[model samples]
Target chain A: MIGAIATAIIQATLVSAVYALIAIGFTMIFGVAGVLNLAHGALLMAGAYVYGIVVMRNIVPSMTYHPAVGVIAGIVVVAILSLLLYELLVRWVEDNVVITFLSTVILAVASTEFLVWIFGGQNIRISLIEGQFALANARVAYYEAIGFAVSWIAIALLWFYVTQTDDGRSILATSMSERGAQLTGVNIRMVRAKTWIIAGALAGLGGMFLGFDSGLSPLMWLNPLAVAFIAVVVGGIGSIKGSVAGAYLIGFIEQITVELIGNGFRGMPTLILLVGFLLFMPQGLFGREFAHE
Target chain B: MPVLQLEDVDVSYGKTQALRNVSLEVEEGEIVGVIGPNGAGKTTMLDSIAGYKEYSGSITYDGTEVSETSSGKLVNDGLVYCTEDRDLFPYFTVHENLQMGAQFRSDDGAVQESFDFVYDLFPRLDERRDQEAQTMSGGEQQMLALGRALMSDPDVLMLDEPTLGLAPVIIDDISEALERLQDEGLTILLVEQNSTFALRHAERLYLLEQGSIELSGTADELRDDDYIRDAYVGVT
Candidate 1:
């Protein structure tokens, strides 16, 4: 029983990090573009499926050379996909928030259904770094630990990019007051397009890691997207720090719940927490600045 | 040579005509004042020239046709319109806001020089470089807005309403700054409700009434007119 509890805690921590990456990118697009992209989940699925195909089929040729190539290919595939989507679909209806959101929902549902049709609704496993690590009295998978570490590094890098660079500063300005930014020569449209691409790429990375951790499935992205939305809402709409903090909190809660109760009731506690958060602290654990709007 | 010219420009918003056949010009090193009562198309005229509002006629700047040019390209070509509302990104520090002005400008030394120039123009902004812009007072935000335009190194600076919501002392300070820029041989297009302020600072003036130019003359000529005095000064 003690061993099972320990394993649940570790699994929860690993899963939380993956969710953090998705929430971070989603919150970023909301911050920069001021729209709720329901297609975000589909983008995540697409990334995972794309990466899965590349790694499984050795499409990149050099991916067989190293594990790092798999990561790079994953980023490139999602970026290209994101760019095309933005140019073709998202751009035309950008200013109309309602239309864009509906389009995103349509896109998410269609893409998910299409993938299930193609991949046959069965799980396809990926073995990027398949090994176990023993720490103290507990044995855990190396990929889980690696996923957590990669998430932290990615979040850190993203935070740095948003705060330290000129482009990042402009993006922040765009998030706050797009018209103001444009008056000062910010390429508002291009900035948003670039943001979508980056968000998609980050989602790709999260999906890639998730695929390696727990096999690729057409529907694997939905659960993570739900958790990501929870974290983003609990953290605050557009706040970076809030997203990270909320993710860790949610991750630990799930882990503890599974240990104390069971897997069947693991989701109930999160739902209750989310409801409580929305009722009392609707601004989020931080503030509206962190919330995705 | 006339550096900026708007010839028989007609502008509309949906169905309502905002500016009707409004024509104006500002020569190099000229401070051109535009005065009018409310809804006299003062802002509409400037917006038309700035490419924010579409106009039917031609807007030529520095001998180049600019009726169809985008605002970004026009800004890069050294025509900047400082918006009236004094909008600033609330989340950014004063320095960051200033840096955004130089987004298209790549020169480090020149950017630094412009930064220093703005600081010199408004020492209060330099004092609060790291502070968020939203925390500043209305006058300071106006100064920052003007400072932002200066960073673009624009050839013709069009100020919509620089003195709005500022204290009388700050308004004086802003007027002094505009005069200094004028002394530096910069062209300006001034739009203001306060005729006293405009007449004092500008070399030439246009009086706009209900979307049309009612009067055009040298500043001294407009300053002495009885009708102008009765309309603007509230003197019978």
Candidate 2:
């Protein structure tokens, strides 16, 4: 029982980290652009598929399913895809965020379905680093631990970048007021395009890590999408710290539900939590400033 | 040649004409004030020069036409517009807000130099360099807005209502800063509801009313006119 509890704690932390990575990207995009991209889930799916393709095609045959490679591939693939999206769709309709969001949804749904048609609906496992280690009486998967650590590192790096650097402060400024940003010579369009790319890369990386944690499947995007939505909504829109906190809150609750009730009931607690947050903290904990402004 | 000149400018928002036949100029190192009631096309005139709104007119700066450039590109050519209202990026630190003013400067050293120069003008910004802009006092934020414009190292700077809502002391501070900028050979075009303040800063002034330039002359001439004083300056 002690071992099971330890394993559960480890699992929750790992899962929360992954969720944070995904949620951070979503929050950044929404916060900066004031666009609720329903298609962010599609970006996640696309990243996982891209990784699966890259590995299967032996583009990097020497590369195994190492967490590092997954992360690198995830970030790179998502960044490229995000750039493509920016050049092709985002720039043309940035003024109409609602339309841009709807267009992204179409893009996501089409791409996801297309990938499913190409890769088949069945699960395809990326072979892990060959072995599992024992922690107490429970067996801890190496890939899982790696996933957890990589996600935390990514989140930390992002927080530092967003809060510390010149470019990051520009993003924070853009989130506050686009006109204000422009009056100060902040090339609002460029800032936004760069934001989309960063958000995509982070989402992609998170998806790749998630694929390693669980075997890739056609419906893979749904889980991350749900978690990201929950995280962003609960954490508050445009608040990075809030997103991270929300991720952990949802993560631990899901773990607790799975361990205590049943795997089938796990989603119920998340739903309840989301509903509760919406009812009580609709702006998400720190979003009150932006709620009316 | 004038530092900035607008010739027969026509600007419209869909079918609504915001500025019609608006022509004006600001000479080098001169503080030109534009005053009018609300909807007098004052903001539109500034917007047209900044490239935020399109206009059918010849806008020339230092003898170069500027109607074709974008707002960002215009800054590169040394045209800076300080918008009305405290439009500082609320989430950014005071230092970052100033840095944004130099976003187009490709030379890192020049950017750094500009930052220092702006800091010299607004030492309060340097004192609270790392604090988020929104948390600052209103006067500090206004100073930040002015400092941000100066950071672009512009040859001509346009200010739109630098003091809208603030304590009387803060207004005096803002007015002093504008005067100092004018004294240091920085050319400026100021738009304001405070006719007294505008007359105080500007050597020459234009009174706008209902999208037209109703009166234009030296500050002393406008101040001496009874009708101008009755309409703009309060009768004390």
After superposition on all C-alphas, the RMSD of every candidate to the true structure, in Å, is 2.7, 2.8
In the range B73-180, model 2's lDDT, one tens digit per residue, is 778778888888757777677887787777666788888888877777777888999998878987898899899889888888999988878788888878777777
Candidate 2 local lDDT, residue A17: 86
- In candidate 2, which residue ranges exceed 4 Å CA deviation? A57-71, A90-101, A134-138, A288-293, B106-120, B123-127
lDDT of 1: 0.82
| Superposed Cα deviation of residue B36, candidate 1 (Å) | 1.0
Clashes of each: 8, 0
Report lDDT (Cα) of residue A120, candidate 2: 71
**Docking quality class, candidate 1:** medium
Pick the lDDT winner: 1
DockQ for every model comes to: 0.56, 0.55
lDDT of 2 by residue, A1-293 (tens): 88789888878887898899889888888888877777777787777767766664333455446545655676788888877877887778867867987897788678768867877778877643557888767676777777777777777777787766667777877888888777767777788888888889888877877777776787788778889999988999888888899899889999989999989988788888899988987888767457214
Chain A TM-score by candidate, in order:
0.90, 0.90
Candidate 1 on B1-236: residue-level lDDT in tens?
A: 69999888888889888887888999988999999997999988887787777788888888877766777778888888898886677767899888888888888899999998899988999999999887889998999999888988888999998887789999988988897898889899999998888998988999999888889999999888989988895652
Off by over 4 Å in 1: A1-13, A57-65, A136-140, A288-293
